[model samples]
Target: MMVRSLIDIFSAKAFEIDPLHFQDDDIHMKQALVLKQVKHVLHKLISEDPLESLYMVDIIQRLGIEHHFEEEIEAALQKQHTYLTDFSSNHKLYEVALPFRLLRQRGHYVRAEVFDCLKCNQREFTEKYGEDVKGLLALYEATQLGVEGEDSLAVAGYLSYKLLHAWLTRHKEHHQAMYVANTLQHPLHHGLSRFNDRSIFLSDFKIKNEWKCLEELAEINSCIVRFMNQNEIIQVYEWWKDLGLAKEGEFGRYEPLKWYMWPMACFTDPSFSNQRIELTKSISLVYIIDDIFDVYSTLDQLTLFTHAIRRWELVGTEQLPDFMRTCATAVYDITEDFASKIHQKHGLNPIHTLKKSWVRLLNAFLEEAHWLNSGELPKAQEYLNNGIVSTGVHVVLIHAFFLLADTVTKETIAILDDIPDIIHSVAKILRLSDDLEGAKSKDQNGLDGSYLDCYMNEHQQVSAEDAQSHAAQLISNEWKRLNLQILTPNPFSSSFLIFASMLQEWYL
Candidate 1:
């Protein structure tokens, strides 16, 4: 049977997990923990009616009540570092005379530190980074404004919208803070290493509210640090002498799947269904899969394998592989089959769009192999080929997403049409930009140069924008059409902002 993550089954909306990753587990584990914890708690509270788990909101209130009393007592006792005084002052920093919370809520009662993290972090930031850290605290508070835009929030009326913005805004703040923390004191260059401690310098480098980008920046920083250390390079973080170290709080972990080919749990959209998480999943999958292809498979065999999954399903014990392949094949079948079943169960259209897309992607992968014979340095525009070089394991991740999207109801598809376009556009632009960067380089040691085959003794200049004279251009055109669909109508939304920002980073 197909075992879905609890997060997948519950249809969570944002970044909450079952148990947070141990202080700082892999991001995937952290994602699963938050989602599972949320779903589990909600399931417990509502028992027979998990959908009505809004009752848990009262628990937050109750927690707030006790927290408030504790705060008063703490203040009366002349406590300086408690949450109440800090968050309250942080609120005041914004020039808003509003109470720390809208009501009589307090710190003692809220459910431990999980639900009240922004407040906890607010206090921590004030105590450590100084009260001047109000910009982040302000961003946290700003989510309280009337939540507009999304139809779901619109239908929820004002109160629930406020609650949602409260949480979503907090998440945005967490990502922003993490971006700052991981990037701080990390050198972009050797000469620049000495300036890492400059707070003014740090102020200029920031990752915005979007989860994916911040997560990526943090991961890349860690990867580079590890790579440098392995080579015995000078440490970048040595400059923080006498500056009080930032206290470590719990971050999340990665929950590895049975199939290494499957995505890291972290990228699963807080609200992903069969369709959307594919984009995020691809953020990891492209590179991993590229590695597999580069090191493992041949072109013809990969094509055969692609064709197999299009119709493959686990039938009985008889068809299983003897070892790890069985597990991977099982997951591969389950992800695709579950998506097909969900649509079938709901009487949704049987498009099999994902399967079709995967076949196309597989063919694209195979085509890249042939380009090895093309006698030219592959550029970024050769996306189907360079998924390994730029995006890495995420190249074929859209196949999973396409499956999930097809499974969702047409209403959801309509609402989330922007997602697919965002994925394709970002992937395409990044691929080209990365390749062009390599083509333009003389050093040939960095990202651009490392991927460039400088001495292609027999050269063919395939147009960066066009895959080929025939079949490739059609596919490219279709991809562009999808992007155009996203950019039309409401082009300035958050989804678009992510799309545009990633494009800007990849390109000019």
Candidate 2:
């Protein structure tokens, strides 16, 4: 009895929206004016109410635009740390956690004992303020920076995670619940980059009507910065084209954009544009060589290729398979280019370190390949000890240091050679993250097994879910190791930390 529909019934409505609708025609002028006013407000607060100044910086960071006011933020934090000695005595739990997190994140050495008072009074604080959602959220985010043996911080982390989950379950449809879910999965402390491109930060400011101009200005500035980044990406894309490796070939995957995105995530500042491009090219080469070992090469060919890399010469590739020859020559050529640039700029050639890293990487890859082919699954620890090297973390760090170091000294090289505790932890993190993903997708099981496979095989009674949970625990422990290491004195540059943070972020 129903009439037939005249229109196509399956099509959904389009949801096109302009992000910059808040800005006027003179966007540049408006942005500059807003920036000035925001700075004035910030300065005014610093003198009138220093606590509000710290809170404002925290808000700016949460909004994902603190990079624009790094100097002012740093100066304000320094003042707070210098002048506000007894401030923690009077503040709430959220207030206590906020400054601790902000200062630690920026490399200021705030002691873990700063939270000792809160820990001692935990019983009373929970009874009176347990349901203070804002304080709980702040305390939870702060716990992400927890270190090894920090029992109170660890307890806080667990409790906050549970409370946040419970809150989200009760208010599943709330916008704040969506944010809590996101944070529970990948906390704001480590996953800031993921939110960099989202409009949620902007939306929050717009809805509040405070700092709305600053958020609008951030959008325009981000747009301009993104355009510049696109230009840099194009140059790298052109270089990939020159390598002639992007052509249809069974030997490897052609994903120039994919490679570029990693370095972009690692170091997004415009000053490091060239370094990002160079690192992208090197990582791209790594992927190509990895495919050769993982998917295409015979054991004999892998051995030969390993020897060629060890020899550090293109001539050594004369006896290899054609595919390997392409890879070897390209690796050698690109490495030399990086070494040459460093030599010209810094008067020190890091070619030896670069070559040694590649040799180690190849040896690790060959070991994994041998394990898979021989039908001998290594013990979990045995696989991880070598798998860490195979993660190519040392390779990435060696090249990253050379590019970013203002002055490469002997002590720095020795620290790098020893592989600092933080760097080692980073390797474990990357390897675990990779294996967890590979297990889920059945991707790394082509010729080589994964951490999950090894773990499950080692303990045949363990289910896949249990194995994964175990791996997740290992990753969390390593993050604690890394968090502790970063708090201490180290020889690594700020740029290197930025790179390391990005690597951790990718897995998150």
**In candidate 1, which residue ranges exceed 4 Å CA deviation?**
1-288, 310-331, 337-351, 373-407, 410-421, 436-487, 490-508
lDDT (tens digit, per residue) of candidate 2 on 239-283: 877886665375335757667766765665656788988898788
TM-score of candidate 2 versus the correct structure, residues matched by position: 0.87
> Which regions of candidate 2 fall more than 4 Å away from where they truly are?
1-34, 82-90, 120-127, 194-198, 201-210, 251-253, 440-448
At residue 190, candidate 1 shows an lDDT of 8
**Model 1, span 128-213: residue lDDT tens:** 33423333332333222211232221222222223334444556565344433323212111011211233332243332232233
TM-scores, each model vs. reference: 0.35, 0.87
Error of 2 at 98 (Å): 1.0
> lDDT for each of the candidates?
0.34, 0.73
Worst 10 residues of 1 by lDDT: 243-252
